[model samples]
Target: MAILELAIGFFVLAVLAGIFGARGVAGMSMEIARLLIIVFLILAIISLIL
Candidate 1:
């Protein structure tokens, strides 16, 4: 839940940064968001399996 929210926050940041023309920050935020979403999904799947 928290991780999902964090990921969402990062995604929003990326979108806003991109709109503002901050390519580096947008790219970095997007990467971080992707990582966080992957981690969150993995954790969710593990939790369900366990």
Candidate 2:
């Protein structure tokens, strides 16, 4: 799903930012990734139930 892909992309961005020593950016990106993943999971569950 698009949300999952966005989460994965953000995860990769976080990793790269971390490697580059951008702690703030990395943290923000990782937080976004986590949120996206949670949203994706929720959507998937709702879709399944429906």
Candidate 3:
């Protein structure tokens, strides 16, 4: 699930980059990557705790 989201995020970023600009793509991709990392860590911790 997490991987899928991350993949989609990157795909969107790539498309946006080609259509719009590098800056927008970079910003969005960074944000998505950050969020994905956070979520992935949280899920890992929760699974370990349980």
Best by TM-score: 1
**C-alpha lDDT of residue 8 in model 1:** 99
Off by over 4 Å in 1: none
Give TM-scores for every candidate, taking all chains together and pairing residue i with residue i.
0.98, 0.97, 0.61
Give per-residue CA lDDT, model 3, range 1-50, as digits (tens). Answer: 76658857776776677577687777777677777777777887899999
- Estimate the Cα RMSD of every predicted model relative to the unseen true structure: 0.3, 0.4, 3.5
User: How would the candidate models be sorted by lDDT, starting from the highest?
Assistant: 1, 2, 3
What residue pairs clash in candidate 2, if any at all?
none
lDDT of 3 at 10: 76
The candidate that achieves the highest lDDT relative to the unseen native structure? 1
**Cα-based lDDT for every prediction:** 0.99, 0.98, 0.73
Q: Write the per-residue lDDT of candidate 1 for residues 1-50, one digit (tens) a residue.
A: 99999999999999999999999999999999999999999999999999
TM-score of 3: 0.61
Better-scoring candidate (TM-score), 2 or 3: 2
Where does model 2 exceed 4 Å of error? Answer: none
